[model samples]
Target: MEYVVSHIPQGTACNRRSAYKMIPTTITIHNTGNPSSTARNERDWLTNPSNARQASFHIVVDERQAIECIPLIENAWHAGDGSGVNSGNRTSIGIEICESGNYAKTLDNAAELVAKMLKERGWGTDRLRRHFDWSGKICPRLMYDGGNWTGWKTFVASVDAKLKPKEDVRMPEEVAVQVDGKKVGVGEIKDGVTKVPVRLVAEAFGANVLWDAKTRTVNITKKEAV
Candidate 1:
């Protein structure tokens, strides 16, 4: 999938240099619980840095539209600790179907988008289950307390009906370079080192290069680029 940089709030940050190196086997659905529009939710995650709760998920379908937050390759902090373990945060992708403050149409879209996500991910109905199944919490209440689990079931069933193994897809170019940090992009790697160009080296990180053709010496400045 293509990575697009949008308006990310300041608070949303990752704790590590690389994405959580685990392929998620679960999907977690959540409710914002505070009822927020798509923009509001994004803002809250970004601007409220002090809250110390920074995370993202694969997708969020809300009043505005389905937002692609944390890229599919990275981990998002959407799962919360319940009972004992944090099941939904990193090892599982999260979908926040906003149900707070009055916005509700997102429910239908959330269901549809989830089905699409499941199909795309090649996860079958057997792998599909509610977050409560893992943590025993009343979240995404409409799916729990509202007594209409049919939506979730229908989505899973659709996934199962068309289950087929996806072809062995080649890893994306970005996966090999180990540049999951902010603002880093895919580039060629040579001799166990990605030889960034003298001119473009600055783009990767804080570094200055002085190319002395006579001495074959290239001075590089090192610091955080972004």
Candidate 2:
């Protein structure tokens, strides 16, 4: 879940932070569409003013790592929704998954990152949207073209699985009881109760333990201190 933050400058033309604010109600996922660029390269390209004018996103994820190009609280011109008040650019956090390197691993990293964002924003998997959802463009083109939209569903499932709570596991430990600095028989915890043999404990404490067969009872006696 570790990510690199190489945020774009505050007043960069690519990210107009003063014009609009972002509340991040939704997470929009995209694919870089470049077959040879890594997340770092994408971040660098977005940071450059010459390349920043066209489009920008909050983060770019690859197989090995993720890089943040823009702050999540500000809008990046990624959604291609044009100039609208409720455009995805203004209300969503955009993430571009790099197509370079191991495609499957990159997708997994993106899913993990998105799952964390969902948990932080208190959003569900329902809030996950594809670039194609906002506009007719076939972004994350690999998932759409390769799996015929089924891949997107599987990705959402991965994010949902990550959000699930994990079960707690407890291992039993052997409990030991000591008397007068001497080791005695081991005790055990069962059904939330500690069980130990009374005779063993009494004998370990230098007490005389006797069994009465007639009444079926056990007795212990310790000598008084001199």
- In candidate 1, position 9 carries an lDDT of 39
Q: Assess every candidate by TM-score.
A: 0.52, 0.72
- The residue-by-residue lDDT of candidate 1 on 1-226, one tens digit each, is 1223343432345441125555777777776665545534653464454655544555666655766655555566665552123455556766667664435456656656665667787765565556566566666666553666766565455545445556676533332223335534346554455544454546355566678899998777776557
Cand. 1 Cα-lDDT? 0.56
Q: List the residue pairs that clash in candidate 2.
A: none
- For this target, which candidate reaches the highest lDDT against the unseen true structure? 2
The models' CA-based lDDT, in order, is 0.56, 0.83
The C-alpha RMSD in Å for every predicted model, in order, reads 22.1, 8.3
Task: Locate the minimum summed-lDDT window of 10 residues in model 1.
Answer: 1-10
Model 2 reaches what TM-score against the true structure? 0.72
